[model samples]
Target: MEQAELTALLTAQGLRMVDEIGPLATTGEVAAAVSRLRGAGHSPDLVAAVVGQAHLRTRAAAKFGPFADRMLFTRAGLEQATRLEIAARHAARFRDAGLTRVADLGCGIGGDALGFAGIGLDVVAVDADETTAALAAYNLAPFGEAATVRHGLAEDVDLAGVDAVWLDPARRTAGHSETSRTRPEDWSPSLDWVFDLAARMPVGVKLGPGLDRGLIPDDVEAQWISVDGSTIELVLWSGALRRDGVRRSALVVRTGAAHEITAASDADDEPVRELGAFVHEPEGAVIRARLIGDVARELQAGMLGEGIAYLTSDAALTSPFVQSFRVREAMPLKVPTINAALRWNGIGTLEIKKRGVDVDPAQFRRKLTLKGDASATLILTRVGEGKAAQRLALLVDRV
Candidate 1:
């Protein structure tokens, strides 16, 4: 949305009209709502802005919950904003470290700023985009003096009184709706400048989970966070914010509970062993944090093969870091044999999972003719490497 439209949408009258009209789900509903609003004497620009915001707010509910109702968002800003639950955890780290004030550089729509302010930390939220800064001001209005929104370059922001810094570099091209991934070197404020600042003060840098490990600075604690089974982002904590004795960590956040596994250094890989009765798939965050070997050791499990993250053990083990599945049977990776075996087992529906293999699960599933009442999971993978490698299909059930 343009600055004028955003200004119009934030007006008291526009907000009331948006509330009265409520959320518009489908395109038909949005078009109808726009027609009705224009019929009621609202300008086309105002109607369009209100309707678009209503839809965005509904989508934002999944990320910000109740806070989304009153918040204004730009399409690209909302897409890159951190989830509220995860941002809260980030804020907790600052609060627990006794930090009283923080500078949130590159704060898009103030997602992390909201979390910091909610926990009583004064926030100076800065964004390079003017419209986004205005929206952030609107969203952070509830915090009053505790939150300050500024429109400027993150590198230009004055940090005289700030106790800590949280930086989320713009990793995508700047646009309201159309954006593409940008190379790490092209990041706004630049990683080189960010790390330079980190050396001077406590800082937390948010990056993609798949960032190259070699670029990570020594003495900084790198953490990978996963929410609801999906690995989200990697955070590098520096200076006083770095946790003692923890160099690498994986934080798993589920519906009602959260768990963390930390290590002083990367764990050694477990030895490859014969296929056991159970297979363990390490959580994505664990794998990203390079802590899959730690999980393997915890469960007394061994690697299925070199460079494979899968673990196997004779005994069924339970751990929050991994999802354990009971192995029913194994066979060579052949479609006809697997189809016949499925038919013999009365399996009608199949959940296909693959790793360390080239087979596309969707395309492979179509080749099988499913007919029966039972359902089962099929795992396709390579058990070894190079010339000695063997393709295997294992039918399993969740533990």
Candidate 2:
């Protein structure tokens, strides 16, 4: 809805018209109210309210909150925010690099800005969207005078005295006219433009986790970040990317402890192996740090298949990155045996993970009859017996 009408409705309802509604209202009720406004063709303010509410509810409910307040709404465009730890890492990196004062150019909801301020660093968080700037203010409120939220274009913002700048361009393409997306390139200020700005000041560019490694600027430390097992974000650290593989690091953050995987050596090295009961998957940051082999060595596990991301162990080991499952049956790859085995187990839930297989999981599962209450993970791969084969890596649970 239009801001004027939305303001009026919020005033009438005594709602603050903030980033999201914290009331325990159901989505159906909110959707119905929004639908009524839409039916009247008045485009009520409840549209944003409903959207915001729905997003918050879904996000807060997820084991991992999907929303990152650091996501920016800059003049260039809107973009997703980075995870807290990832943002904090960047802030720490900049601080250690001697960047005393920094400008989060496209500071979205202030995710990274808060990280910077948390470390007692000087940060000027800038965003072009009024709504975003307001939200960022609330998110960064605890920082007090140490952090400031400004609504303006990055190029237009006065950042003369800052030693470093961080930017996350809006990466959504223009095709999102029918959706909520802005152009992907617009997510941050133009890269070329920002590059010019970075020539004078140190800069950090946050990009998609799946971004092409080739597109990474040579001078920037291109680092991919994965939290838990899920790869979340990639960071480009200009003035920090090192030839000796220094900037990239993989980290696994947990409730109790944190593990790290440093960058790989330039020399070709063998994978680490530990004869353990279970193999652990390294944290995403660890994997991105090119320390997967290092982790395997640390865990004393060996690779099961060539380029197989899974680590295998005969000993019971507790690690965050990999899950442990019993090799219940090592039968040859056959549909009849697979189907019979699955049906015998009453496989109600089937998780198919394959490294080198052409068969579709849906089709494979469809051919198998799963009955009663039971769950199992069916692994399909080329178990080279002169042919590719499928095996059931009976999963116990996420390690």
Candidate 3:
């Protein structure tokens, strides 16, 4: 949104219209609302901003939940903003560590800072983008004196008296929709600077889950979090915020329940074993944290193959760390062979999963015409080693 549109949206008149219009979820809904809004003598910019924000709130519901209804967002901000549930967890760490005064650097749309302020901490949130800072201030208005928003570079922010810092360095270039990923060195508040600050103070740095593990500092606790099945982020905690002896952590959150597995370092991979009754696919966070071996031990399972992440065991054991699937049949990884098996099993809907193999499930699905009501998950993978290795399809059911 332009500066003028934002100015208009900040007014009592503009926010009122947004609440009345509610969410314009569909393109058709947006068009009809835009036409009505324009016919009512609203300026083109105001109409555009209101309509766009309404649409975004509907989309943002997935991240912000009901809080989205009162919040304004840019396309990029909504995409990068931490989910409310995840943000709360970040806040709890600071509170538990007795760090009350917090600085949320690179505070996009006040997502994490809201978490801080909501917990009664004094939060000074800073954003490099002027518009984003304004929206953050607006979103955090309910907290009164507990929250402060500033439009400035994160590195320039004076951190004097701030007991703890939650640094979320901007990873994407500046834009609403056309932004691109920037190299780590290009990130605002460079990783080097962030790490230096982390060493001096209690700090929590939020980074992309896929960030290279080698770049992680040896002293900080690295926590990889996954919401549902998607690995969302990696958080590095330093100083007092770092839990004692917890170097690698995997936090899995499904619905509202959360489970965590922590270790001092990467756990050793268990030895490979023959395929058994149950095959387990570890959660993304577990794989990212390199804690697959810890989970494997808990389930009395071993690696399915030397390099593969899948685990197998005769026992049908399960845990929050992995999605357990019971093996039904195994066959050559050939289109005709799998197609015949699908037909024989009366399978119509198929969930094609592939690991350690080169195959496009969508394109490969075209070769098979499933015509029955049964549904099953087909895991295409390679088993064994060297010349003995062979590609095979394991038909399985969710346990």
The clash tally of candidate 2 reads: 31
Residue lDDT tens for model 3, 259-359: 99999999999988888999999999999999999999999999887789999999869999999999999999998999889989999999988899999
Each model's lDDT comes to: 0.90, 0.59, 0.93
Global Cα lDDT for candidate 2: 0.59
- The lowest-lDDT stretch of 10 consecutive residues in candidate 1 is 382-391
Query: Model 3 residue 41 lDDT?
Result: 98
Q: Which parts of model 2 are misplaced by more than 4 Å?
A: 1-26, 32-43, 46-51, 54-79, 95-100, 128-131, 137-144, 174-188, 192-200, 240-247, 254-257, 264-289, 313-318, 372-374, 384-399
Best-matching candidate per TM-score: 3
TM-scores of the candidates in the order shown: 0.96, 0.74, 0.99
Write the number of the candidate with greater TM-score, choosing between 1 and 2. Answer: 1
Q: Kindly provide the TM-score of model 2 when superposed on the true structure, using C-alpha atoms.
A: 0.74
Off by over 4 Å in 1: none
Backbone clashes in model 3, listed as residue pairs: none
Backbone clash count for every predicted candidate, in the order shown:
0, 31, 0
lDDT of 2 by residue, 325-383 (tens): 65555545677887777777677877776655667778776777777688866666543
